[model samples]
Target: MARVSQEHLEARRRQIIQGAARCFSRDGFHGTSMQDIFRETGLSAGAVYRYFPGKEAIIAALANEVLTAVRGAFDDALAGPRPAWPDEIIAEALRRVDDVLLFPPALVIQVWSETFRDPRLAGILHGALIGMADAWAKVVASYQENGLMSADVPPAHVARVLLACAQGFLVQRALLGPLEVQVMSDGLRGLMSMGLRRPPEEEPGADAS
Candidate 1:
């Protein structure tokens, strides 16, 4: 038998992954099955099985791919000459996700729901969140260095909040309808501009009377 090159093997895996993504995006995690994947890919059971044992494994692989792309977006923005602001960083990350994922972003909602039932999926997502959070922390630190953000608050805490904002954008887009990146970014910028101010009573020079 002629040996299959590594490139061919990788191509086949990508074919399977892309097919699975279509099925999952259309029918969702519970609705999609291994058989559906085979049909979608036009691959026999044994051929598909050779790459992934079941639908969950395929989903796990897809989730990892999507999350990695998002993280890469953050890394790319931070690697620029100047640190990107919160809105700029998130907008870039969102754009990267839109450009890179073979599946629709809405498919991530299904994956998030499946995480409750599948610890493996949850673990994969959790690890990705930790990595993204660290990247956001760097952004926060940069803001502090430039006197753009408060240095008193822990960067990690602020990072998680910023990460949540990005995740919230995905959730809103998935459920409510399409959302423009600029609209979301503008909202973030507006919120950040409302700098954390102390009340009159708490101001150092305020009169108690």
Candidate 2:
């Protein structure tokens, strides 16, 4: 047998994950089975098993992919040049979402739904949420320091709110179809950008209030 290079092994794993995503997207978490993934991938049972010990592993990988993408977006958006307001931060964040995760509305939704049923999945989801919120809390703190974020709200709470809004957008994509996702996403971006701005009652460079 030919030795499989790590690159080849990783590609094979990715291919299996894509297959599992298709199954999960079409049928759903409880509805999908390991055999279904095998059929979807057109890989023999042995081939599928070689990469994933079971369906849970496949679902975990796929779910983590979405989380990882979102985390990268959050980190990148926050680390880049400062936006003028919170909503612009959201706009930039959603742009990354659209650019990276929006091509298949059902896929992301399916991955998210799995968290509801599995404790392991819930852990992964919770970890991603905390990861984003913590990273973003720093961003919020910076805004507060710069007088960009309104002092009326705590930065940590604001960070959690932003993450909740973005996560809600993912749920919307699942509930709505692809066409509506684009429309809803546009609306979501608008909403996300709204409160992060300094109130008109305040001075331009006023101490946070």
Candidate 3:
């Protein structure tokens, strides 16, 4: 038997994961079964198991993919030669969220549902969020240096707040649909714009708004 190339193996795993994403998006985690995933992928049971031992492993793969993408967005937000504005950072992060939501917007709801029962998955999320928060802290510090954000709040605290908002936006956008996402996006922009407005003390000879 010819051993499979690593590229082929990874492609097969992604194919199964994409199909499983469709299933989980339609059915809640409890409602979804391995058989459903097998059917969704149109792959034999043995083929599916070759990539993922069980449904839990499949879900973990999806979650990790999401975490990696979100972390990459934060990295991009800070990689430019100049610091990005708050809206720029949020927009980039939201773009990553939108990319994952493509598989099915409802998929995140299913993932969140399973976290209540899955400690390992929950730990994965906790660690991902910590890493994400640490990256955001750099963005926050950049904003402070640019005088776009207040200096009183610690960068870590600001990162936590932005992360909470982003996570909340993900759930709410998934639940309420794109119209609400547009509204939430506008709201976030407005709030961030408020932060960028310089205080009179900081603005030299500025007229009161």
Global lDDT of each model? 0.88, 0.72, 0.80
Stretches of candidate 3 off by over 4 Å are 1-3, 180-185, 195-209
Query: What is the TM-score (0 to 1) of candidate 2?
Result: 0.77
Worst 10 residues of 1 by lDDT: 96-105
Structural similarity to truth (TM-score) of each candidate: 0.87, 0.77, 0.84
Give the runs in model 1 whose Cα sits over 4 Å from its true position.
1-3, 194-196, 200-209
lDDT of 1: 0.88
Tens digits of per-residue lDDT, candidate 2, 1-209, equal 99989999888888898888777767876799888988888899999899889888887887677667667766676667773355555555566656544236666666666677889988988887788889778888888888765666687888887777766776765676544344545665577566655566685666766
Error of 1 at 193 (Å): 3.9
Q: Which candidate wins on lDDT?
A: 1
- Report the Cα RMSD per candidate: 2.9, 5.3, 4.9
lDDT string, candidate 3, 85-108, tens digits: 655666667777677655766688
Model 2 RMSD in Å is 5.3
Quote the positional error of residue 58 for candidate 3 in Å: 0.7
**Model 2: lowest-lDDT 10 consecutive positions:** 177-186
